[model samples]
Target: MSRPQHFGWFLARGFGPQGWGYPSLDWDYDWTRPEIYQEAARTLEQAGFDLVIIEDAPSLGSADTIDLRVRHAFGGPKHDPLLLAPYLFQATRHLGVVPTVNPAAYLPYTAARQFSTLQHLSGHRLGLNVVTDTGSARHFSDSAQLGHDAAYDRAEEWLTGIRSLWRSWEEGTLVRDPDTGVFADGSKLQPVRHRGAHFAFDGPLNAIPFTDGEPAIVSPGGSGRGLGFAGAHSDVQLALAPLDEASVRAYRAKIQDAAIAAGRSPADIKILFAIQPVITSSAEEADRIVAASAHPDDAALVQIARKQSSDLETDLTSLDLDRPLDITIFGDHVSRGSIQRLIGDRGEDVPLRAHLTALARTGRITDRSGFVGTAEELADLIEELGDWGNDGVLLWGDFHPVTLHRTLDELVPVLRRRGILRREYDEGGLQANLRAF
Candidate 1:
């Protein structure tokens, strides 16, 4: 029998607007209330999804101005996902609620205590998606930003300290006997004295040992240092790799090798591909949606350019859209991988305006990519990828209630019938459920 595939949803806008421009007459459209998230979590739970990850960033994009970012809602005005976690957990029983936490933004002690407390309250269903903040460091009151590799180094130290703090109080540390005067076992508790290059902490964590161990550690980055970090530290690694089977397999192999080098079992680390599936009832309808979704008009083009410029820290507005772009101008400001993907097969001499326009028109600039087809066709694609050594998929949709409802009510049932998806969650916490497959 085929191994059961894990399924997760990538909440790009944590408790915020989804399906930015798309019509959502069915949605309540009130983002401030937790009802939308609660409803979404319930839907995923009913569908037997493994987890729901809330993606977050500390700063708005590196754009020259916040106007575009706010106006377009590309990366502006997001409430903390951590705040939403408790509400989500209360609303669902089995589905894991993983919130993104930037190591750079939070102190080790604070993160340890917060996550540990949640883990205890949620029956160990909480998860932490550790992110190395890459947005403008100035936003965090830093005079200068660390280089790419150095940031990961800092994250490594941060995670090490966090883990140390979590282990401060061992199991059985608490001995609450009403008859006896002593309420706890002092000998069992240990203080964490960790001094690292990036961070230092001295003392035991405030929280007690978690019932199911530490909250699941999730790492998301595709760079060399990122893969290494994920292999060594994370239980799950979210990847946004190319959709081709060979490329995906190769990336998985790289991560597996890193895990082996790090003295970890390959199976201990699960790599989930990030995908956005466009599902429709019929092939013709699917084609129409895909075609419409691919092409964005003038407003979308501006929004895309503005978002990219903010992220790359380069102002695309100043550059003439009709003229070719000088890649040299970006210098170290932008990620090389991002630039390469944007340029694609086109030479550097290609006009910046044309590039952004093409991205806007094609709707390919965003991180979301996957098949546009009927539910069964989409399931086939997911299964084929899983058969090629992928652990699971982290799905992103248009965020319309109808779209999400269809994915859960329509697509998931089909997968379950084919034995591609789980019929019910394994009895345990988030970590156990993750390791079940």
Candidate 2:
């Protein structure tokens, strides 16, 4: 038997091209329009998913690398996810739309008012996936570029300010007396004056309060500082870890410990691991796909190189394939951890082609190991996570109808049969759905 768990989808490509360069493009869905994502949101809501988190990185690569960023469509060319959230909300009643928002891009007071308005509009189903990427600071006039930990600090301060604004309306502030035609009691509204190292704002946000519950907070950071911020403030922690039991336990323990250290209950935070499982029709097909990736041809290698170039903001496509990359190729701005992950078990002496080749290969989901598998096999991995006391898994993919159906069509039945996925949503909304199990 398996315990029921919360599930979500991560719009891995943000609001960018939904099916560009992929076979899904043949479906001819206009990625620029809202219909593609609205349909996807309905599919997820009908499938009993609690939320869909839209990932965003506000900047194109640095000035010198804009071509690398948009050429392959690996990054950039994204519209604002916050603006897209309302369409998603209008599409589904229970599905939470959590768009990635950076403190650097939005002012505290404006964000507070906008988010609160959406919360009420969505019946408390709106959520913000707070990120602290400083790469986009250059785009905003008032934004200051900060180091990693400092960026987290600013985000913490920024959230603290927004929440303060959300709580500005007192318990008895709304006294709608039809007889007197009085809508609100002005004296009951509290003045919110906040002055923090990163932000200063005054708000008794004009937006009405959320009746179900305030929009649930979501965070996606794996560093210690990131964990601390999430533990202290986030309702859902977008986690990443090895799928095995012990690693799952350890990663969960870190989140639990962080919450406890912050005087917060571990139960208050739901840790949903991020996974991109390639669902195959059968185990043999999974094996065949995995084997075919081992010796990636020139096209495959270049594709990987283009993606890496976008991520590192340094061109890798023109590099000599036979030679090891220069250690200095990455700039001071690129994340060390990201570079290390891309390097992946390679010494400095390893050839650039060898590194990209390794990335092209993937693994199976057998023995609770990897993410490539059949739908039934993927269900087993999810059930095992539930057994390990995991909250759930967030399926990472583009928000396209074809992509959504491809992943969920076969897998949803398997999960539903095993009692791993919910058949229907509970009353209130997304918050209610998250708290249902």
Candidate 3:
């Protein structure tokens, strides 16, 4: 029998209301209100989703100037994901709330304490999505931005320190007794003293062990080093890959290999691929929605280029649109995965302008992987991928409430009927629920 697959939602805005853009006015309630997020959380819980991940970027935009970013609200004026977790937890019983956090921006001690507190309060339904700030180093601190691998190196150190802190207070240390007037067994508490490459921390955590265990750790990245970090540390790995069985299978194998090399069980880490599904009653309506979401003209194409420029940290506007791109010029500034997707097998001779225009037209450059069809068709696609060894998928839409509702109302039922998705969450916290699969 095929085991049921796990499901999670990727909240692109991190509890913010900017995802649907001005069109959100159609259903606009106060974006600042916590009720909106709570409602979404309740819906997910009802649908039997394992978790909801809040994606965040402290710095937004990659253009030569901040004008475009400001005009579009591309990456600014966002609310903290951490603040929304409590609201979500209060509104739901089983759904895990995972917030994106940059270790570079927060000290290990602070991160450990904050997550530990949330884990306790939420009944161990908390998860931390560890991400590194790649835009600019100055945004994080006065120090220079580290290179890709170096950033992961710092993250590894950060995680090590955080884990030490979490383990500082061992189980059975809290003995709250009135007869002897004893509270904690100090002898059982040990100090975590560490002097590492990127951080130095000493002593035990101030918080008590509140959950069944430490809060679950989630890691998102596609690079080799990123995979290694996830294999070694994360209970869940959020992967981005082309929507094909072969590609996904290869990626899964790579991750499992990394886990084996790290002296960890391959089954311990779950890999969830990011998917954007556009489901409507018919294929035509879904196609129409996809078409409407794309860039309509040359000016819009330029806008896409500008966004890519911001991501690549280079001025793409100056390059001739007709000329082939030289990938080496961008060096390590741009994400390797982005570069691979942009250039593909066409080689460096692919025209910069024409390529960007094509990407804008198809919405591939901006939206990436998407499936346009009815809910049944989507379920078929998902089932096929799962059969190819994918553990699960991270579902996302255009950040419209309608889209999310349709997914819950239409798509999830189809998946459930196929016996591929869980009918109900297992009896446990997030970690136990995740590991149950």
Q: How far is candidate 1 from the true structure (C-alpha RMSD, Å)?
A: 3.2
For every candidate in turn, the CA RMSD to the true structure comes to: 3.2, 1.8, 3.2
List TM-score per model, in order. Answer: 0.90, 0.95, 0.91
Q: Residues 1-437, candidate 1: write the lDDT tens digits.
A: 55578888888766556656566744556777777788888888888889999987667665455665667666666778999899999998899999998777877888788888899888899988987766646666555677778888888988888888888777788877889977778888787888787667786887777767678889887888888999899888898777777889899999999999899999998888887766667877765665785556666666678777655656666777668888887745356656765676678787875677555442221222446677777777777777897899889753456668866667887888778788778767898898888
Select the stronger candidate by lDDT from 2 and 3: 2
User: What's the C-alpha lDDT at position 171 in model 2?
Assistant: 89
Model 3, residue 160: distance off in Å is: 0.9
Per lDDT, the best of the predicted structures is: 2
Q: Show where candidate 1 strays beyond 4 Å.
A: 177-181, 289-300, 328-337, 345-347, 357-370, 398-400
Distance from true location, Cα of 314 in model 1, Å: 3.5
1-437: candidate 2 lDDT, tens digit per residue: 57998999999999999988788789888888999999999999889899999999899968777988898789879999999999999988889999999998899999998888888888889888998877788988664578888988889899888888888988889888999999999898989888889788887988777788888899987888889998899899998777888888998999999999999999989999999989999999999888887899989899998988888888889899999878698865576656876776687788898889888988888855467899999998899889889999899999878788889999999999999999988888777878877
- After superposition of all CA atoms, the RMSD between model 2 and the true structure is 1.8
For model 3, the stretches where C-alpha displacement exceeds 4 angstroms are 19-22, 61-63, 286-296, 315-318, 328-333, 361-370
Q: Which stretches of candidate 2 lie over 4 Å from their true place?
A: 142-144, 322-328, 345-349, 367-369
Clashing pairs in 3: 62-310, 63-310, 321-353
